[model samples]
Target: MNTKRLGTFVAAILVLDAMAHLYWLVRPASDPRALSMAVLNMDVPFTPRVLLPLILLLTTAAIAIVAVSRGRGGWPAKAVVFALGAGLLVRGALGLVWSSGLGTDTGTPFYRLNLLLYTPVCLIAAGSVGLVLARTRRTGARV
Candidate 1:
């Protein structure tokens, strides 16, 4: 995909991920069912106390990178795509371990959801970058 589309896609994933986490952060403690469920399902550390601002900062950075890279074509886009994908892949593996028994708890639903979501997103993003890089390399070889 082109840089613009790639950046937009990356940004979308970042925004969605951030929003999902933020939703969990803002949920009230009074709702016993939800609070209990949250305690059981989510493993995130911040709660509203720390999570909201951090997510916003991360999403903003992703969006800003997209906005700035609109005109550029080449390594920047590829790098970001690869970085995002690699980050996810590594984290997902770690999550599997954490959820399986390595950690104190299996983690929250919110954490699990992000972990699951990142699997495919990272695959697509990283695969796209790898494919592009391979094609470019082959074409360069021909020339």
Candidate 2:
């Protein structure tokens, strides 16, 4: 895809992720433990304290990506988008390993979701970001 489309795709993903976190924050699951396990693959509480900051971060990332998509922001915005992509790439790679039952427990909700959803989304977002960067570079536009 072109730079604009790719950036929009990444931004949409970030926004959706932020909204998901917001949903968890506002209406926590009846079974917090199960929710946590399904989402994080761990028992850590998905408290407001955790979800709030994460929500903010994801929102900020979406904004940065949008700016990059429009070719409006300069280096700083580009840097944020780059960092976001790199982080997602790392997370996706690790998720793949964990889903294989190497680092994480097998037959768990987290493992299944990571394999079916989270890992693939992250990888796709990361690749789309890379394409945006590349397209912008070729067009002599600031990302």
**All candidates: TM-score:** 0.52, 0.94
Total clashing pairs for each candidate: 5, 0
Model 1 poorest ten-residue lDDT run: 134-143
Task: State each model's C-alpha RMSD to the native.
Answer: 6.0, 1.2
Model 2 misplaced regions, further than 4 Å: none
Candidate 2 lDDT by residue in tens digits, 1-143: 56777878888898898999899888888999999888887788889989999999898888888888778788888899899989999999998898778977778888888999999999999999888777777888854
Best by lDDT: 2
**What's the true lDDT of residue 64 in model 2?**
86
Any idea what lDDT model 2 has? 0.86
Cα lDDT listed for each candidate: 0.55, 0.86
What are the runs in model 1 whose C-alpha is more than 4 Å off? 29-42, 72-86, 93-116, 127-143
Tens-digit lDDT string for candidate 1 (1-143): 66446556667777876876677677644564564444334434545666678686657646543643353335554455456556756765665665555653445664565456644565565554444445445555221
TM-score between candidate 1 and the true structure: 0.52
Residue pairs in steric clash, candidate 2?
none
Q: Which of the numbered candidates is closest to the native, going by highest TM-score?
A: 2
